[model samples]
Target: MAPRNGYTGEGGSSVISTDLSHGSVESGESLQSTSSPHRCHHVMRPARKVAFVYAATGRRFLGCPLSGPDRCSLFMWIDEAWGPVLSRSLIQLWDQAFLDSGRAARLQTKKKEMEQAYLELWTERSNMEIENQQVVNKLKTTILDTEIKMSRRLEFHTKMCVAFISSAVTLASVLAYVLSAH
Candidate 1:
């Protein structure tokens, strides 16, 4: 954009001056000339840009280097034509990329869902293992209790049998002595 005082160029072409970019004009840096009538400041040289819209991707254009509301309204294409076949190919490739990106997004979501399901199944398996172990421990404890009770009963029965045998032997000896005396 031109400065408030404007820049007068050779051949009597004077550009309307209020649009200088935020750089000092005395830096002595030269700017490249443009095909338009607008004069460029040192810092506001015409910038080459590429279009990325569908078939126009890779097409180059020249516009004001400074970007803002008050910038000049100059833009021109600098790229050669892509012809009908290449243009169609570029459009088809762009469409394919769009479709593939959407598919990739869906696949990513599905992968996350599968991972979540696997984690839940793993947690459930761990819980079931814990419960099974608890049941086994309870069964072991009950078996030990039953064995201790049976062992105590067997010991009591053994003592009673020994006492009965001792009393019968003593009674037989006493009966023999009485018969001898008579």
Candidate 2:
């Protein structure tokens, strides 16, 4: 007869065995008929709590309670097997979420840096335009001053030439009169 719960024999006998020794039983009939309480202990009990752990910190967190359907879905031969599966799944999802958040933060930082660079470039361009305009103004002022000086020199030379021509004409007329009188 197959054992029920912790009982093994028909007359009600208590059998005790560790998990390592019971794991060698391959046949289902042999596993059920085993006269050891330890062999059936893993098959009789449902898993109660599942725990998830952070790989970096090794801190464990309790997961959600399993429903009746979920408990019934597990095989009786495995002990607390669903806990590790669920914990690993949750940890993988959390890791992906963290990685995505980090990438978004890096992109935001890059955007801020680009904006600052553009502002600095714009400011420099404005300053350069102002300096260029000042240089143009200075050149215009110098050209105007040079043109005024050239005009004044030309007027003085014209006056000197007229005075010399008049003096030469009067001297020549006076010499001709003296020669005729002698």
Query: Which predicted model would earn the best lDDT?
Result: 1
Clashing pairs in 2: none
Residues 40-157, candidate 1: write the lDDT tens digits: 4534556544445455555555556554555455556666767898789877866787688789999999999999999999999999999999999999999999999988888888
lDDT of each: 0.59, 0.46
Residue 26 displacement in candidate 1 (angstroms): 31
TM-score of 1: 0.61
Q: Residue-wise lDDT of candidate 2 within 1-182, one digit each (tens)?
A: 11223333332322222222132222112122222233222254332221222221121112112332332233233223335655576457557766887889999999999999999999999999999999999999999999888888887787778878877887778888888899
- Model 1 ranges with Cα > 4 A deviation: 1-43, 63-75, 80-82, 166-182
RMSD of 2: 17.3
Which window of 10 residues has the lowest lDDT sum in candidate 1? 19-28
* Model 1 / residue 102 / CA error / Å: 1.7
What candidate 2 gets wrong by more than 4 Å, as runs, is: 1-82, 166-182
